[model samples]
Target: MFGIKFFLLVTLPFVLRFILAFSTFAPVAAWPVWSGIKPRNSRLATVAEFFNLKDRKMAVDASVWVRAMHGDKSAFKILSERCESDVRLTEKIYWKLLPFVSRLERYGA
Candidate 1:
């Protein structure tokens, strides 16, 4: 969970917008996000499963993403710790920004 202060009042803020872009459990096995605009897939769970399937790189990134989504405020710090070795900031940011960009395109400015 996270909080934001407004007018000196502390308010716990839940993430109101989150999108899991793709999953293996979707009805259409060959499509991304069931061809919907912004559907929530079982992405973290799928990634966890990927680890078992030997996709190390995607699994590692998804593990960090799962932690962050599940209220681990230090998840980003953990990712930074793996900077040069396991993760690239640009790639992570690009993936993270995708959902927001999609929303912008579907909606208006």
Candidate 2:
């Protein structure tokens, strides 16, 4: 019983980490939460890096979101171009960026 516990304790984290590291699946959605209200700091500056995916459209959308989070409005233009190239990408991107889209509309950005 002790040996089984030791094995699981040592190996479980490694197994889970490996699966997450290699997984190609993107989350259904992601959002940039406020990091803090520190002086001289932007509210949404410290955002997570977007995932790199194998699918071209998804990859582009992820990249665009990362850029957008960094205050680059041109990222949306690239996303739109990708959507124009593939109609299906529009639906996928819409869901993926729903939170950010709402924020943009709210702020009139």
Tens-digit lDDT track of model 2 for 6-105: 6455554344333334554433322232211111332111111122222344346476789978878798777777657555543443444443222443
Candidate 1 C-alpha lDDT tens digits along 1-109 = 4444441232211111112323322122122322332223435434333223322332356877789788797887776565543344334534543543423325665
- State every prediction's TM-score relative to the real structure: 0.20, 0.23
Q: How many backbone clashes does candidate 2 have?
A: 0
Off by over 4 Å in 1: 1-61, 86-109
Model 1 CA lDDT for position 25: 27
lDDT for residue 46 in candidate 2, whole number 0-100: 18
Q: What is the C-alpha lDDT of each candidate?
A: 0.40, 0.42
